[model samples]
Each structure stands twice: as C-alpha cells, then as structure tokens.
Target: MTLIEIMLVLGLIAMLSIGSLQGWREHQQRARLEQQAQMLRIYLSGLQAQSYQYNLSHLLWTIVGKSGCVGSGIKPADCASAGDSLFKPTAPDITVGVYSEKTMGFYGLRNMAQAGHITLTNAAGTIRVILSARGRIRLCSEGKSIAGMAVC
Candidate 1:
C-alpha cells in the first residue's frame, strides 16, 4: 500500500480503538454502580431478616453522601456508636442519596409506615434501591436501563 493509504488505515484503527475504550469504561462504571446498589439491598434485607428472627425492633439510618454509613439506631448519633453497620466510603465515581425516610424501624410482624429509597448515580446511569412499606427490597434503574435490572 502507498504511504498515504497506510496512514489513513492506521488513523481509522486508532479512532475505533478509542471509541471502544470509552464504551468499555462506561460499562465498567455502570457495573460498579449497580454492584453498590445491590450490596445495599442485600444488607437491608439481611437486617430485616435479623429483626424477624430475633423478634426485636431494629432501627436503620443512612446519610446521603459520597461516604456514609448505614447503621442501626433511632438517631443519627447512633451511627457512630457502632454495631451492625455498613460503612461505605467514596464509591468509585458514584454519588449516593437516601430519600424520603432517613430513619426506619423494622419490627417483627409490623408493617412499615412509609417507603424509602437509596439512589446510586454515576455518569452511566442511576439505580434506586427501594424499600417498600411492606418490607420488600427491589432495584430499578432510572433514566437509563441497566443490564439484569428493571427500569423504573
């Protein structure tokens, strides 16, 4: 091939590789966000199950921030007291928000008075970990569809 033709072919390959790399990065970020959301869901579900098994009322409180802890307590102060807590520190390129009810108590054989949700957001999309009043935990994507998850 001529020198000019060879340069054109190389440019095309470079462009394609750059595009593929960008797409791969986005996919990886979305996967990380989804993983964080799923982890929070599992933690909350386990807490609920624990409450039922022990037949005791358990309180859950979370702060909305890049780094925060989900702790068992009637007050935010209890989060620092420590005992059965999930502490998340600066998840990779993701922002987290807890909406509606910040403090919830799970009592055996009693239904929640209101529902709450935690939102995990990245450039790729947003996922909500919702806890229903009936004590159901579910994940739904918002604004963008995520693989293996339902759209909100």
Candidate 2:
C-alpha cells in the first residue's frame, strides 16, 4: 500500500487503542470505588446490627488523611488505594478530617471526599464511612442526614 495509506491506517489504530484503554481504566476505577464502598457498607451495617443504641446517634467515625492515616485510627500505611478509596489521599491533611456519624444505618464510600477537591456526596442518605488512622473505616458525614444510606 502507499506510504500515506499505511500511515493513516496506523494513526486510526492508535487512536482507537488509546480511546479503548482510557475507557477501560475509568471502568476499573469505578469498579474499585464501588467495591470499596460496598465493603464499608457491610462494616457499618454490621455495627448497626450489633449496636446497643436504637438510633446510633452517638457513634462517630474519624477520617485520616491519605498521607499518614493516623489520628483517624487506621494507619496511613495500610490504606490500599487499589481496592479502597479511603486508601487514597491528596496532601496537606496527610491526616485530616472531622468526626462522622455511622450508627443507625449510615454508610458510604469511606474517605471519598476532600476539602479543596469537593464532590463527596451521599444521596441515598446512607452512611459516609471515612477511613480511620489505623486504616479501618466507619460511616460519617458533615451535612444533615435523613437516617438512611450515604448514596455516593
């Protein structure tokens, strides 16, 4: 074939490959995030089932920065970013966050939100479990909740 035709064919192939790869990566990320969210949900659900309080309005979950994963309970070193969003952290607050409510059936993607980088929202009104200093996690949110699930 002509050189021009060959070049055109290669270009098209490259473009298609790149696009497919990008889409695949995003899909993987979404699945990973969803898996992490589900894990946190199970944990919080267990807590609710084993809790003594009827409403669980007192239990709170601490958030640990991705940097050091301290102060929050789970050590930063243990947060596996591959399967858990809590394992991911930007910076500044190598270990920053406020306490959250996880009792009474409140759970969500742990540590999926940041200050400057906003977008952490739970619509299902479920729980928003944040990562702990020791790498553990629990449900918590800053806004008013409706006693449901933290729909992210």
- Return the top candidate by TM-score: 1
- Per-residue CA lDDT of candidate 2, range 74-130, in tens? 234344432342323332222333343432122233312221111122222223455
Worst 10 residues of 2 by lDDT: 111-120
Give the C-alpha miss distance for residue 130 in model 1, angstroms.
Answer: 0.8
| Candidate 1 lDDT tens digits, 40-143 | 77777877888877776777667656555675655455334655466463365777777764566567666442467778877888898887878888899997
lDDT, model 1, position 40: 79
Any residue pairs clashing in model 1, and if so which? none
- Please, what is the TM-score per model? 0.85, 0.44
For all candidates in order, the CA lDDT equals 0.74, 0.39
